[model samples]
Target: MADNLLELDTPVIAILRAPTAARFAEVTAVLQESGITAVEFTLTSEGALDALRDCADFAYPIGVGTVRTAEDANRAVDAGAAYLITPVVSDEVIHEGYRLSIPVISGAFTPTEIHRAWVAGSTMIKVFPASLGGPDYLRALRAPLPDIPLVPTGGVTHDAAKAYLDAGATALGIGSPLIGDACTGGDLNALRDRALALREELK
Candidate 1:
């Protein structure tokens, strides 16, 4: 992790992953209006790099997720991504993000993997598929790894946001539960509603 890691202004990192980024601008705008400042543009989404570049002047921090390769990390950095996120603990990806002076939110599940990722220099450990073990699982992990910041991702619903935070999550990575069909051209008003509700829940 770099000394200048992207600050998490909000607890939720809104994940926008769809077939394409055609709705990115609209979705992001609604999220911002709703007070959700952190966004993750997953490379798994088509045209994500170009979309990220298009948001060069976006008001908030937008990171690139699902980055598994160094080349992808470089491309994302070039595209103006504020940070990087990986699905698993990949030292290559972590090192590339470090070299680029970008923070990497490395994903891990087990306690060992979590510690390994932190040792590998990830800015934060994303407890992927967090729904599998839920908040109690996070609480257990925090018992021993109190110093490491954790961000629970995957199936993070608005209703469960506070529970995760209370379980020691530094932040959250919310996808479909918060996004719904917004990124796929669903209703922006509905997206705003969800964002607002989620933000309020966190508060």
Candidate 2:
């Protein structure tokens, strides 16, 4: 199993949230088959911690998202999470990640928040709800803060992925647009099709 995020070649982070994480393995297998390896399991899901411990042997980076507190961060790390992702800028979470030596993708919306997160030692700044500003906003942010790696999450569609990358997004945090009910007893085939389509779009 791979433990390092640096080994991830694809710049796409699949954000998975569901009623239960029992179907996580099945869904992750489909994504892996489609060439999207990086996956984030949000704590809001049922049995997510157990799933993280269960998927420790997976051969790709598996991260924990929606992390808000230091206790959750520690718990995730103890459960073998390769990285931690937050929905907002939390100094405690970022410091915990730094202490644990795990990467933290801190979420932020405005330029001030982004810079603050970067300076606070966030591994990457997740420009959340990126649909609001779109690629042009990313371009504007990159103009001054070119060195900060940005991952745009929330409402990133397959067709718009390339535009985000073109706008200087280091990676994308995609959810429903890619997962598409796969974890909720929806068609696995449909999920695969979407994943394949996303791969093609990225290429």
Candidate 1 regions exceeding 4 Å error are: 1-7
- lDDT (C-alpha) at residue 80 in model 1: 90
Error of 2 at 187 (Å): 1.4
Using all chains and alpha carbons, the TM-scores for the candidates as numbered come to 0.96, 0.95
Candidate 2 contains a number of clashing pairs equal to 0
Question: 96-170, model 2: which lDDT tens digit per residue?
Answer: 999988999999999999999999999888999999999999999999999998999998998889999999998
Model 1 TM-score, all chains together: 0.96
Across 154-192, the per-residue lDDT of candidate 1 in tens digits comes to 988888899999999999999999999999878999999
Candidate 2 off by > 4 Å: 1-7
Error of 2 at 46 (Å): 0.9
lDDT of every model, 2 decimals: 0.89, 0.89
Residue pairs in candidate 2 whose N, alpha carbon or C atoms collide under 3 angstroms: none
